[model samples]
Target: MSGTGTATGTPTGNESNLESAMQLMIQTFHKYSGNEGDKYTLSRGELKEMLTQELGNYLGNPQDKDAVDKVMGDLDANNDGEVDFTEFIILVGALTVACNDFFQEYHNDDKNDKKGK
Candidate 1:
């Protein structure tokens, strides 16, 4: 643990992997959040761009036509119509959990396949 940026929330380039990932998440959020009013949050267009660009692997090529709207609706917990940092974190956390579950299941399935063979 580099213990870097413990107070400032800025990455010191010497952080642990987990710390680096956290910084990346914050950086990614700010990147798109600045495109509209309330620089601390994501507008619908910014959210769409971020999803289409950053989450393409999981969200799909063009993604479901309704993915942006649906995701925005779900993530806007306060019904503010824009996703704030906390809401964004919730989305990321949920996706991470889902991905972890999926990979764990996949790994288990592969192990079972080898046993069957």
Candidate 2:
């Protein structure tokens, strides 16, 4: 499939796997970013909502104020009490890398188990 953009700002829908993943990331970010304050940034409330709703499984209990506070502090690189798209992307990228590492370790362990049988 050709990975090209149309003049209407819509993707050709023939994007490669990676391209589709990237688009999903953008869409996910915007889905949670523009609820409270700036349309382009995620306020604390918005971030908490997104984390609780979208990443609850990975992040554990979003109702834990301390956990949310730590995450907000860590992700707010500018100390502006808000997370911009770049900051949000960084968080997602870090999580993705960590998940990849976890999967690699699991796969290796499974392979070893099979070999031992």
Candidate 3:
């Protein structure tokens, strides 16, 4: 709706659509870090390397090569390049619209529930 950042710090408009961003991040993370499947945990070096290689298209070419390096440095919670589950969840949650929309798309409510309507 409004292209404004909320008082609680929720970003609206284009910035709020985090699906692409999450997908990009996952793809990039998986690319450099060997996917451990259920056990997949990223190391700092693995995360940093993936960000440089995969996020280039989305994050843009840094004015200086180490620009992204600096960014990733800050985001890495354990000082490891890889973001742990909690950090990743928080980031995605901030970007997602709401829990209703999250489940709505998957449930396809429009096509079903016609037993009542």
Best by TM-score: 1
- Candidate number that wins on TM-score, 1 or 3: 1
Report the lDDT tens digits of candidate 2 across residue range 11-98.
Answer: 6778878877777777778888878789899998999998998889988898788988888999999999999989998988998999
List where candidate 1 sits over 4 angstroms from the true fold. 5-8, 61-65
Question: Per-residue alpha-carbon lDDT of model 1 for 1-117, expressed as tens digits?
Answer: 355666535777778888888888988999999999999999989998899889888767525658888999999999998999999999899989999999999999999999999
Off by over 4 Å in 3: 1-28, 35-39, 62-65, 80-82, 88-117
How much is 37 displaced in model 2, in angstroms? Answer: 1.0
Summing lDDT over every window of 10 consecutive residues in candidate 1, give the lowest-scoring window.
1-10
lDDT of each: 0.87, 0.85, 0.53
Question: What is candidate 1's TM-score against the reference?
Answer: 0.89
Q: Which pairs of residues collide in model 3?
A: 44-80, 44-81
Per-residue lDDT tens digits for candidate 3, residues 1-117, read: 244354323344455455445445555445655754333555555544554565455445643447656655656667745666555555345435555585787578655776568
Selected candidate, larger lDDT, 1 vs 2: 1
The all-Cα superposition gives candidate 3 an RMSD in Å to the true structure of: 16.0
Residue pairs in collision within model 2 = none
Question: If the candidates were sorted by their TM-score against the true structure, best first, what order would they fall in?
Answer: 1, 2, 3
